[model samples]
Target: MTDDLLTRVDNGVGIATLNRPKALNSLNQPMVDALGEVLAGWASDDEIRAVVLDGAGERGLCAGGDVVAIRESALRDGVAAAKFWFDEYRLNAAIGGYPKPYVSLMDGIVMGGGVGVGAHGNVRVVTDTTKMAMPEVGIGFIPDVGGTYLLSRAPGGLGLHAGLTGSVFTGADAIALGFADHYVPHQRLTDFTAEIVAADVHTALSRYAVTPPASALAAAREWIDECYAAGSVTEIIAALRGHDAPGAQQAADVIETRSPIALSVTLEAVRRAAGLGSLAEVLVQEYRVSCASLRSHDLVEGIRAQLVDKDRNPKWSPATLAEVTPDAVSAYFAPADPDLTF
Candidate 1:
């Protein structure tokens, strides 16, 4: 196993800890490979009755995948980044389909790839410190790693609002939106994990589950549903802009800062994913968009501005929402070579 990931067995539990605390445990190719191999072994191991996944850090469970690494690879050759996504997506599918009871302790910032690892588990526990989002659009990419499947299934149109604005969700908000199964204080995580190793998964989780505080997203459901249910990105932006509510206007402003192509493509992906039957199906669709994104000028520019130069200002290809046409957006859905399959 790689030094970045720790794996062990205690009693009947298989424990995996993301060990790169300094980078907020952000996943790299090596870490992903180590995790996938370990989980595969535990899946068929009769001695392992349950699996517990957590990250080593005070700041968060995981920030996201190593986007800086992906960016560097993309700068040299697109194949490297594509290979990372292919492997990462396969790991995501494995986590979602794991036969054994899988529990995730999500204590802090869970976003993008972080969401894929934790949220897909059978039992997801969030704490007061948890802050989650699928903020891929900010970096000029659609939310992949089954994000479309998760977000599209959210009640009403809250998911659309979140996808478009890259809104952050608190622990309570995550449970409210069905992204998390339970809430336990951060202090109790150690004991809860130990309980899983000693007892049954359900019993251990029930022992620690607590009612989460009121969800901010729940309070804004009506506004989110009304504004985000529009037919297109332009329509949604117009609704947000015209609304008298401060939340709507603020959301609109945030959307404006993101790449127009990314937002438009994300909306299309979410809408299409809503009708799909399975995570595998959504992943294949996402793969197409992900590959297309690599070829787009925005992906490089966005990464350069956000990470390489730390400029925080990306000059998007389609500078305005109006410039992102239906044909342009549709091209992203075209099938890729060696299509992603279950």
Candidate 2:
């Protein structure tokens, strides 16, 4: 459909490849539109039984949406960034509610917007090289693209830990945290997809998928559940610091480095998502948060530090956790002007 996104049909399966290997196949406006168009066209075609998403290079499936573009737009009118998210969030919902089986080959470096596209599919496959993360907190953004919905549904504190700390977890951790289903080694990925194209999704899964290795999250669940069970972000961090688990103190330290206001809003967003009945409902809430974030100083600064300047030093407005008031965080919940509709 476009240079950034390549689409093809083989047998009964429609295959789409993200073609920007050098930039980790980071999604742009055109790629997102192409994916939506392809999926919409395939949704009604009786000849296509399933759809698969893959990245062109060996590096990864997708890093994320073009945040650098978002940063530039945010530095401008913020209109373009909003439109990108509006369409991208809709695409995320379409993938989740797709009529036919949607398969996501989540091989490596799947993060943020990447999770929106790859993890929402019904048949999500992960490999050992897969490193999935919702690292928005690191860039002064909340996890959108139904990330709150997926993470909120994760067992106990694992989801909150991921959202707050912005840490990357392995494929085993991805499966444990409910981000993916079957495990197929990278070496067999091509053969496995061929199986799906030749036969059907289930048959391919049965033939090549195997049990993933033990996840670190599974072992840390005892303390993770206990610490993250706190009602608020502050309390959660304190609990992590006080806990004796292997990753607890480290998680607390990592969260301390993120934008304070972003962390506060992210905590509330994930918590609110837990109560939402469906992914669409959660997306609506996420849209509100995303719009609110665009107006905030942190989002632009976050992107500048992480992408534009590569300084890795964002001076968040509210520098400390205690400085972030409840009202400041509540502003992110207000209804967006150009609202998102399903």
Candidate 3:
């Protein structure tokens, strides 16, 4: 009954609207707990044939988890952070394995935690305005919520390009990258929403779905695959910097802005996740990385510069990519105390 999430049922379709438009529908702890409980209940409710997830306002579906709160918790070693991640990751696993048809209307800005709630659904709809990314490294955080899992499976080294650079991609890129199933223009959104509410998803999609516009991400795979498949982030950056392709140098610039520690850990995590057998396995890995990040110096500094101070400049320890040792990276993979059991 909290105001953050609005839920109702119509035509046997359970609908959940992320209600914090002012904050771009960023998820808070209560929102996470409530969403999990609601989804769990809907799983057993025979009257509910499907579920629909969307956000309010024209700005975006969601910005992400409440990072301002996360930053504060990190300042104190964040016992609260561990629990928040525990519940959030569990919700991610549930959504990935959700029994009923789960749909996410992924229009407008979707990033970080936004990708978690929107991308894992069975049916995801993107609009022309859709701008999606998993830009966790920029803030000294690894992509959690099975983000490494999703990015790991993207075609060629596109996932690596995305994870390393934290770049934004369009709806066409979303469809091409397997993060979404359909493209419905933004203008048709109201009609599409109405259709799904009145009838079933299939009927609504059949009429509304259309071919996506071109994907620059897909088109640039030739260079992206070659540059990002290098042995290390340093090597990849070198490759991008040397390559003569259109966006290669720009990609290198973006990667350099991220925390060296976060970048190293994230690169390894995505590679490991690619070999992982399931989303749950990847989530388990993400949990370990996230818990480790909760205690890291860069996580606090990154948030301070990026969010608190608005400085847009973080003085990272082990600032240079060369200073990041395997030991520093390995700590992220060590067994987190009290492992998260599926």
All-Cα superposition RMSD per candidate: 1.0, 0.8, 0.9
Per-model TM-score versus the true fold: 0.98, 0.99, 0.98
lDDT of 1 by residue, 98-195 (tens): 99998988888898888999999999999999989999999998999988999899999888888888879899989887789899999999889878
- Tens-digit per-residue lDDT, 262-327, candidate 2: 999999999999999999999999999998888889999999999989999999998888899999
Question: Any residue pairs clashing in model 3, and if so which?
Answer: none
Q: After superposition, how far is residue 261 of candidate 3 from its true place, in Å?
A: 0.9
RMSD of 2: 0.8
Which ranges of candidate 1 are over 4 A from the true structure? none
Error of 1 at 146 (Å): 0.5
Candidate 2 similarity to native, TM-score: 0.99
lDDT of 2: 0.93
Could you tell me the TM-score of candidate 1?
Answer: 0.98
